[model samples]
Target: MNSPEQVPQDDDAEVVEPARPRRKGIYALPNAVTLAALFAGFYAIVMAMNGRFEHAAVAVFCAMVLDSLDGRVARMTNTQSAFGEQMDSLSDMVSFGAAPALIVYEWALKGQGKWGLIPAFVYCACAALRLARFNTNIGVVDKRYFQGLPSPAAAALVTGFIWVMDDAGFKNVSTMPGMPWVAAAVALYAGLTMVTNVPFYSFKDVSFKKTVPFIVIVAIALLIALINLHVPGMLFGLFCVYGVSGYVVYFMRKAKGKPVSVIATSTDEPDERGLH
Candidate 1:
């Protein structure tokens, strides 16, 4: 019904208007990996319930691997988003938090009855709190160090302990020789570490830009290969050492009235690299 001039003007306006942005889908590549990791955590719970403890432990380990990759993958693909971060935290809570607690409890703590369940819940609750705090404080906290023990590290400690014990044929020890108390002790330690204020190295800021001796890289590579060869045993031992190392550093810091810097410090005052 419009005149030709009016019709052309309307058409031109429609053409010139910016197109609305398309809504993104949930099926992003990195998100797919994150979901896969979540599935692995769920699968671990199922396997643990079926009395397949070793398989369940292995699944948790796989989840850890996938969890580690998801972020790096997202960054590489330029798919980093608030949604991905939130989803990753939720997945981590399930994989490194609830699943590990349930797996360890069923494997060794069930025999302890109510006593065993307490520590399991403690670890799980602590992990949840840790994740929540991490999510809330992400950019505010120093990226170079974690304020508390990372959930993955806590999960590794628990899973590795189970793996080493199982491999060494100590299945019955968990029920005897005051092992329930030992399990409780381990759980307590893990939970406390999660909520503690101790600064642990994040390794997030480490980069190749820093000059390093060639021999150092070779030594690290060989050490990692050696550990991989032994697998669960060596891995368990290393995690145990890492857990204890925090306390040792804490004590040293207390003695000195200040935290010791693990990284190199320049002679110039007001070191930028040092944790303030």
Candidate 2:
């Protein structure tokens, strides 16, 4: 018989190592939120197919809200999982990538013939690349800034234009004089910016759980009221500013000689080449 200090390797010796616990079933609550977002994305695609472009745009926005909530909820409840992350990424690609690309293509770019499809495809492709890069660079990229115009922001840039234009009495972008070319420009701009090296503030530093003065709540209420007063105008204006905000950040960083590129220097991860 082997002494207690002498670890026995014989098959007859009783194995004493601790048994590893089996993983429990997937956590439900946070992933439920992710599924809800996925449903919203699917709803957007269906609505777009039905030619109710306005409803589709709203659904995409709803997905954005739901998507934003899931990660936070996961963190708060200790329910984060690989499944949830993968689901969220897939949902974002549909909601923010394919959905916006198709909706805009159907609504406006379809009129531009072959040229229109080009920008829409570019937008869709860029959104995919952005999401993939985001997944691979998690915990390596700076939390305060995104490496590029986020896929959602790009979607908002594209769809916000649609929403505001549709609300502004232009039922079809092609109907407006010179609007087809303009829509094409917007699509290309939103797409290409998503893959650029410029940085956009991620707002990750803001802790939702932190307590603040009563005035902050008051400010939020005021903002909500403002949005209610002119929903399309307000939202479109906000996203328009955000669509161009990365360049503003980039130039400001250059002026101050601060780091303009978001690539983390000390990470062991391989660089994503050819992204511009």
Candidate 3:
């Protein structure tokens, strides 16, 4: 605290303390985007409850897109704030964590009775754990590779399966032979993957502002066309590949006898544990 000082104006003034300025309030734009993402996640859950699984899946995917944009927009606009960051994390939990778990459970797991709830709860819990770990280890972890499957990607993996099956005219997961079993496996896999030590590509090194060759643009165009051909199947397949890519990295590292940890340094996170 600042010590009170006396003014010597007329030798008759009492001492007074200086007033401190108030801290700034939260930013508007980034937080607005974060709230929109949160709303999308909430909408997905609500839709799932109403038996609109396809819409729910779409809503979760929408949340993922919006979640990705909020951070970039905040950074680009110079509006990044602690409030925005926290809001983003919370939004992600709802969007990529809880929403996917609930939606998938409603679509498939609910059919398996109590057994179905196990993977959903595990996934939800793992997502929470993963997000907490991410927040605490922001500067201590590797940037090019995520320590585990990202929550958004995990959410995408589950939601994409729902979208693909729903689009294929499968009215329910249990009706399809082995679909419920497959979905349960996906849930457990995605959930467990979130808390694993396996390295998944972060794509952080891919800079948007950097110049690229002409073929890169053409390739992107072609990619868009391919996706347009079959949105659900293509998206699900992409996320499935990404979902398992972490294991591929882990096995590759193991085969080479390299230290497979994703944390920046051994001392940085001595307690770091992941599935090898």
Best by lDDT: 3
Q: Going through the candidates in order, what is the number of backbone clashes in each? A: 0, 1, 0
Clashing pairs in 3: none
Residue lDDT tens for model 2, 100-186: 999888888787779889988999999999999999888577667788899888888888888888877787665567887777788
Ordered by TM-score, highest first, the candidates read 3, 2, 1
List where candidate 2 sits over 4 angstroms from the true fold.
1-25, 268-276
Q: What is the Å distance of residue 202 in model 2 from its true position?
A: 0.8
Error of 1 at 199 (Å): 0.5
**TM-scores for the candidates:** 0.83, 0.86, 0.87
lDDT per prediction? 0.81, 0.84, 0.88
> What is the TM-score (0 to 1) of candidate 1?
0.83
Alpha carbon deviation, residue 99, candidate 2 (Å): 0.2
Q: Choose 1 or 3, whichever is better by lDDT.
A: 3
**Pairs that clash in candidate 2:** 196-276
Off by over 4 Å in 1: 1-27, 172-174, 208-212, 259-272
lDDT of 1 by residue, 120-238 (tens): 99999999999998877665566677768888888888878777777777765556767767767887788789888777877787785799999999999998998988788888787
